[model samples]
Target: MQKLRGALIGCGFFAVNQMHAWNDVEGAVIVAICDRDPERLAAVGDQFGIARRYADAAQMFADGGFDFVDIATTVQSHRALVELAAAHKVPAICQKPFARTLSDAKAMVAACRTASIPLMVHENFRWQPPIQAVRKALDAGAIGEPFWGRFSFRSGFDVFSGQPYLAEGERFIIEDLGIHTLDIARYILGDVKSLTARTLRVNPKIKGEDVATILLDHEAGATSIVDVSYATKLGTEPFPETLVELDGTEGTIRLSQGYRLEINNAAGTTVTDVSPKLLSWASRPWHNIQESVFAIQQHWSERLRDGGETSTSGADNLKTFALVEAAYESAASGSPVEIGALL
Candidate 1:
């Protein structure tokens, strides 16, 4: 099989993990890299040993040498970069939250569909080992006919230390972190029918709401609660861990702290450790997320090579992105927001 040459745009904090992941991917390589910041571009280029580098995206697209492009830039730049990739007839993998707004996301997807290029949003939380374990248990009927669920990600970790811009955003958690948890809820339960939400800002230092609880009515008749907070302080911090509770007709499945998975049903209770494998480049606390980044990127490479649509293809992620939009609307209006109407 011929290796797929991929160009990575953006050399930010998270992009380093992506660069490392691309190195480990079986059928792909980062032949080129682009970043607006020369220092970042040079640093990543030197680290990855990528010779081709570009300061301008248009220049990179014009002199395209790679088969696909990975846009790891912020949300504000996603639509433009994806559209540029479409124009260049290059398959694209964009980081989430896919775009600044639902309308922009829809337009980006439409552009790629028109160009007949595969477009994937980097929604990797569902690919986390523990999360996948939960999904597998659901598929195996360990939890039959899931009726109610809760996806909770509460942490007091100082996220601002690494990404100071996070604290500056007027729309913080829901757009930044909650989007992942919301997508995870949709992944486990099903597509949502409607969503009602409430938001609060416990930390006055930040501009946006630090806490949000969203009530989702799933199309499959299951209801779910997605709650996220950066203000919750615990005896032992569950930073970066997503704790899940699922109740089904047969029994229940609990994905607890420390990657512990428990399933209770007619066969009796079974407990297992579903911890993520710590990659050599990964660190403690963030290893789970780092591992997921690799898993999703590998999935993208395989799907692209096989001419198959990715799990988080642009068309599919619009449904997940709709939940983000619905959550904010619902939180502000104090009413249920219909998912269909927004999508």
Candidate 2:
């Protein structure tokens, strides 16, 4: 099979992982790179040995030879960049928080659909090994018919150090971190019908809420809680780990902090390790997220090659993005927000 040639925009802190994952992915390779900052662009280009580099995205699209464009820039640039790729009839993989607003995300998806080009959101949380294990257990009926679930990620980790801009945003944890947990809830439980949320700005230094607890009512008649906090200081920091507790009609599934998965049903209790592999370029605590980045990117490449829809296509991500909007709205209003109305 011919490998997919990809052009990546944004040479920021996280984009480096995408570049590394692209190298590891079986059927994809980044042929070009773009970033507004010449220094950062050249640094990433040199680090990855990508000679085709650009400071302007428009110019890159104009002279494009790649099969897909990966928009790894921040949320503010997402819609415009995705639309630009759509205009060029190029398949695009956009980094999440899909857009600045749900409306913008819808427009981006519509633009790609109109152009008949594939559009995927880099929602890699569901692709994580532990999370995938939880989903698999549910699928195998080990937890026959999940009715209640809790997806939690509480950490005192200094995420703002690497991405200092995270502290500057008016909408912090819910938009940045809670979004992933929300997507995981949808992935493991099902689509959400309604959401009620409460937010708190525990950290005085940050502009937005550092903590959030959201209640979700799934369309499949399941209830779930997605609670995320960057202000939490635990005995042992589960920095990048998303712990899960799922209760089904027949049993329970627990994905603990140490990558331990436990399932208890009539058949008896079983414990298994679902740790993510540490890639040569990956380090501790972050290896889980790094592995998922490769998993999602590899999925994108395979789907792009096979002419199939991605797990988190732009259209599907609108549902997840809607939950983010509803969380903020519900948090502010102190009421439940209908997910259907937002979508």
Residue 313, model 2, lDDT: 99
Tell me the whole-model lDDT of each prediction, alpha carbons only.
Answer: 0.95, 0.94
Inter-residue clash pairs, candidate 2: none
lDDT of 2 at 187: 92
TM-score each candidate: 0.99, 0.99
* Candidate 2 Cα misplacement greater than 4 A, ranges: none
Please give the range of 10 consecutive residues that has the lowest summed lDDT in model 1.
Answer: 161-170
Off by over 4 Å in 1: none
The lDDT, on a scale of 0 to 1, for candidate 2 is: 0.94
Q: Could you tell me how far off, in angstroms, the CA of residue 75 lies in candidate 2 after the best superposition? A: 1.0
Estimate, for each residue in 184-284, the C-alpha lDDT of model 1 and write its tens digit: 99899989999999999999999999999999999999999999999999999998999999999999999999999999999999999999998999998
RMSD of each: 0.6, 0.6
